[model samples]
Target: MKTLWDYTIVLQPDNNGTFVAYVPAIDGCHAWGETPEAAQSELENVFEMIRDEYIEAGQALPDNVELVASHAR
Candidate 1:
């Protein structure tokens, strides 16, 4: 079972009054909603579906990329 910390989710607002969320490490793993909270909730569903697909095929989830800030202002 994968934990929430296993992946990094990027949530951004769109110009059209909606929010978009996606996992950088997983292709096609994304969702959109009217708010940031909604977007994240939808993203959870998307990730679960993708995770199950990988499991049924006996594959491990891809490791999340480490994001670090190299510089600070």
Candidate 2:
């Protein structure tokens, strides 16, 4: 069984006029996009990569960091 971590995604305006999305619970898990949806879409990839790295290192990622959405994204 896999333990999934729930994190709150924060979106902000970048200096370059792009949108930046990130998960506060995960360090360096951020990406920039031209729109909010794109930024969030990119964030999923970053989070997945980070999660894989943690598993490969035999480390457990943080769990239930924040509230998760009730619906699918």
Candidate 3:
């Protein structure tokens, strides 16, 4: 049984042509990639690690986090 965490990720293109992604609700959670899909994928991976850490520490996730529509991309 895996816990589902909803995190909002923002993706932006850097001047160097790579995309940068970050979760505003999770500090220090960010990643970069050559495309929007890659950036999103990396961000999701980061979210997983963050979620695991919170679960391990018995801490609550942010209340505002919600799973946005998958097709929103």
Best-fitting candidate, scored by lDDT:
1
Span of ten consecutive residues with least summed lDDT in model 1? 64-73
Q: Output the lDDT of residue 55, model 2.
A: 83
Q: Report the lDDT tens digits of candidate 1 across residue range 1-73.
A: 8844589888899889999999988899999999999999999999999999999999988989766657767
The lDDT, on a scale of 0 to 1, for candidate 3 is 0.76
TM-score, structure 3 vs. true: 0.74
The model with the greater lDDT, 2 or 3, is: 2
Q: Where is model 1 more than 4 Å wrong at Cα?
A: 68-73
Give the TM-score (vs. native) of candidate 2: 0.77
Q: Which stretches of candidate 2 lie above 4 Å from their native place?
A: 1-5, 63-73
Q: What is the number of residue pairs that collide in model 1?
A: 0
lDDT preference between candidates 1 and 3, better one: 1
Q: Which is the better candidate, 2 or 3, if ranked by TM-score?
A: 2
Ranking by lDDT: 1, 2, 3
